[model samples]
Target chain A: MMKWIMGGLISVSVIVGIITGNISEVSNAAIDSGTKAAQLSLALLGTMGLWGGLMRIAEKSGLTNVISKLFRPVAKFLFKGISPDSEAFRAISMNITANLLGLGNAATPLGIDAMKKLEKADNPGETASRNMIMLAVLNTASIQILPTTVAALRLAYGSQTPLDILPAVLLTSLCSVCVGITLVFVFDKKGGRT
Target chain B: MRFSDYIIPVFIAGILIYGLIKKVDIFDEFTVGAKENLIAAFDILPALIALMTCVGMLNASGAADMLCSAVSPFLEKIGFPAECAPLAFLRPISGSGALAVYEQIISENGPDSFAGRVASVLLGASETTFYTIAVYFGAVKAKKTRHALPCSLAADLTAFILSALFVRVFFA
Candidate 1:
């Protein structure tokens, strides 16, 4: 699937660029992509380290256990087979907590940790497990309680009430999360034995 | 002031105080965790470059714009502004690109305009599905993503469709 998507994108881009006489720009972007990607990684490193460090402290202090315990019911419902007391569930709960707080930088490192745990337990194979897919879906449809960056952008643009759209954003995100989880469940039922 | 400003500080403080009370070697644990995470970051670089290259090519070649234009008519039928079509298309594909489209919409239409409000909500609600999927799955060396991509795209579709509706219902 990744191969097909990548191939199709590259080929379609080349074809379109040629037709539109934008081939030079396309080649330039492709060539510069590595530098842009490395720059992004560098930017991400500091936050990842800070959050990763803090999360490690949380884990060692048993703070994650408390959090996982608090979210046990939700985890039980969403994660199915995973034990609420397990490392994977703990990491998953922490990731969800960070996401809810709109701590996106914190969320990624925690999420990566959770994925590693899930991979260790449910999937030793190359294909992703059902739980893994669900986790990814949940991250994508994350329910952020405060969209600070969007509000800030609105403020910068001189809106009278920058956060006026907060309710709409929250509602939209909630609906999408519900739909996303439901779709994952549907896929799980259809696929069977993952 | 945005309430979000205090979240990180408060969270960090809470974690530190808790760790100290629990007798955890906080600094040692922190460095170990940071080291592991930094190493994990390297695993994601290849995927990042590949996905960014694809997105960059699409952006530079104007293929994204063409796709957005093709779909704008259908979007107008649903009362979603045609100007935001590019945003909805780019939102799942690239974060920075989506932000650029969103800023363009607000600057062009004014922040309080209907289109601007919808774009704001749209941007706030959705994630960069492709980027998140690539990085998270990439870190684990997961080859076949199975239903993850389709499910995420479906959620993005739901978010895009609801952004306009919710904005209308709440703000109109």
Candidate 2:
């Protein structure tokens, strides 16, 4: 259902673009946009590989357990129903950690993996779980610390003080996350028993 | 020296060098990935181009100027700096175009100027609405995204108001 709707929107946009004689402009934009997406994808893949490898090493070294312990409280709050020791909880924490650090490119696979784990944990006949919905919402509104991509773009384009927006970024992201989490709780209350 | 200056270039160079040294088949992988991205971009190009061209047409046709005039009284009442009106219009439609507006403000008014700082923060902190809507919905196979449209637009509005208030209080 959702898929069809999104496809329709994309189709309409493409049709409109063609009708407006914007195909040429689109072709031009495509060159830059394509290059950007490829470079970003490669970078993300590389970082995820590196992080996954390190996580394995950390597990061997006993650090994964320690990190998991550290994140237990946050996991408890964000993933309300999941047991602290659950695989889904751990993955959710790691995914959120990556997102908080503004490593969303690196966080994508972790998020998908976490969702799969959550789905597997759900009762066989149950609908989508509350934790799953909350995780999706939180991920979409993930509070960023660095805003690295935008900052990089600013620097690339010759801004003399790219990092100057750091304080503002932090403040706004904090507010956004707070508001988003609050709304999630509000929705949960209004929607019914979790 | 600020740490930001060295980090970006180093990061890019490190990626390129790593690919070359590891015999990662960087060219083949990069080109393959690039090709896939090109296809995706082309798929969405029509919408993106229409939006941008319409925006361009708006600017050329002077409708944007007139719109700005119509909104000026409300804008002034809200204490949003004059330069930001163009950006307020551009931000939701396009990322690069908004950045161009930001750049213009910074160049003309100086980077540390209140309007420039606000614009910069707004650009960094905010999401590009149409792109995000398209990408996330497309990825999730969500067709209607009934809630998503309103939710994201709300978020944008919150960011805009908060950004303006924050800048006026601190930078101004």
Candidate 3:
């Protein structure tokens, strides 16, 4: 499988890195990677817990119905074969909202929930429907505004001024969103008929 | 405690408790889900290590230095700082790799230097492109993310240009 090839390549590289006088490099990489992963995990747990809880409360209070109503237009454009009132719609919106704030780690569960709902709707277990694929594409290209994890890392590293990249972050994310959405629509149309 | 302190735990507890009361098997389901994620993360470690090491080699070989040198003049002409170019190159490759470059700039030029400030901002705002693409796309098993790569790079390019412009007009 292609997965094995990719995995093999990486393993070889790490071995090569070790064989070189790059032990320190490996150690440094490990430390940095571990710290980042830990921080992200904690942040994800906290944020998802909060948001998921709020979503549950909203569901109980009938607030999700109102929120779904508000999200209908955007949902219609981004996702198809799903009604505005569907569970998938709410999950997709929540996922997008979290991603917009750059809480990607927090968005994963919502994305999974949305996909599950979509799968349930698919019923007969045909190949992934067009909407499912489009949803995946959109989620992958989800435009980020704040880049919070990056900001936190910068601060941790002792940057005197951390928020300087805001304009750049905003502009880049806008372009990505536009391009990503356009490609999804084009590809969905092409893929749908085939 | 502040409202935020109680928010997350209460939410988690409430969900699990509700699931238990409803006989939903939520605990077992969540545990299985977590286990799957752990396996997935482990599976991807090798690719992550390889990509990281290649980036490390690139840094060690001074290829990035040459690239930065080659681009500096053009960057300078555009009113962007020369030092920020290297960080831009490294940003997509490795998050810490870029940060290390940014640190060097701050140390050499002083923390409040124009280049240092810009680097700090860029560091805060950009993603480690390879890591993100690998982990996220790998999760869903979407083999052909044709649009994902170009679109994200385009975004990174936009971020680079806008950061430069903002620093030039406002900070510089």
Candidate 4:
């Protein structure tokens, strides 16, 4: 599946470039993007290290356990089959909390940790579980309480009140998350292979 | 200073204090966790490179622009900013590319303009779905991600539409 997606993307780009007479630009982009990817991964390494460190402290101090307990109702609703006392639950709660705080760096590692836990507890093959799909969808339609990055960009562009769009951001994110969860429920039936 | 500025510092300090009270060997635990996460990051590097290369090629080939223009008319009818068509198309595929386009929009239209506000809300309301899916799925070696892609894109579509609507209601 990953191979097909990657191949499709590459083939489309090349085909389009041929017609558009931008093959040279496409070649350059292919090379540059690889470099960019390496740079991005390097940047993520530092962030992952820092956040992973802090999260470890949180976990050892039972902070994540407390967070998991607080989030049990919501987690149980989203992840029906997963046990609330599991590691996956704790990691998922931590990921959601980090995302809400607009902590992208923290969220990524926690999300990966959650995915690993989910894979371990249930999924034993290459195919994703229903809960795994839900987790990915939830992350994609992330509901952020603070639009910090957008606000910073607005400020850089000289807006008087950068965070003025907060309400709108919140509304849109809510709409997306609701739609995402609804679709997942509709499409991925319970106790069935998805 | 914005209120958000205090969040990270305060949160980090709180974690450190909590760790101390719990008598956790903070540095030892930190390095252990850090090492694990760093390995995870490394594991996903190949996927990231492949996805980004494809995205970069699409952008360079003008395919993204073509699609944006093709969709702009329909978007305008739906009250979506036509200028943000490219952003709506690119946002899911590439985060930094979307940022570059977004910076251009805000600079060209001025951050206070309707398009700028819509773009800001749109950017704030969603994640880079493809990038995130790759990273998370890649970490766990999940090859067959059934329904995740469609579900996420549906969410992105909802976000793109509501971003414009809410921006109008709130600011316009």
DockQ of each: 0.47, 0.12, 0.12, 0.51
Candidate 1 or 3, higher DockQ? 1
Q: What's the number of clashes in each of the models?
A: 0, 6, 0, 0
Candidate 4 colliding pairs:
none
Window of ten residues with lowest summed lDDT in model 1 chain B: B1-10
Residue-by-residue lDDT tens digits, candidate 1, B11-120: 78998999999999999999977776677666677777776787678768988778877888888788898778878877887676565556557866888999999999
The sequence of per-residue lDDT tens digits that candidate 4 reaches over residues B24-91 is 99999999878877886687777677777877787789887787788888888889987787678668
Candidate 2: residue pairs that collide = A2-B142, A2-B143, A3-B141, A3-B143, A5-B143, A6-B143
Model 4 spans > 4 angstroms off: A1-68, A190-194, B1-70
The candidates score, on chain A by TM-score, as follows 0.67, 0.65, 0.64, 0.65
Please give the TM-score that candidate 2 achieves against the real structure. Answer: 0.60
Docking class of 1: acceptable
lDDT tens string, model 3, B22-127? Answer: 5655645565445544454344444444444444444444444566688888998877788778777767766545544564566556645677667755655556
Tens digit of per-residue lDDT, candidate 2, span A1-194: 33453354345435555766665554554344434443333333433343333333333344434555677787787676678778888788877766654544446667777767776675423344555655565665536656654554455445677776777766765665566566656666776745
lDDT of 2 at A56: 31
Model 2: lDDT of residue A154? 54
Error of 4 at B6 (Å): 13
TM-score of each: 0.68, 0.60, 0.55, 0.69
List ranges where model 2 is wrong by over 4 Å: A1-71, A122-129, A156-158, B1-58, B82-111, B128-153
Q: What is the fnat of model 3 with respect to the true interface contacts?
A: 0.09
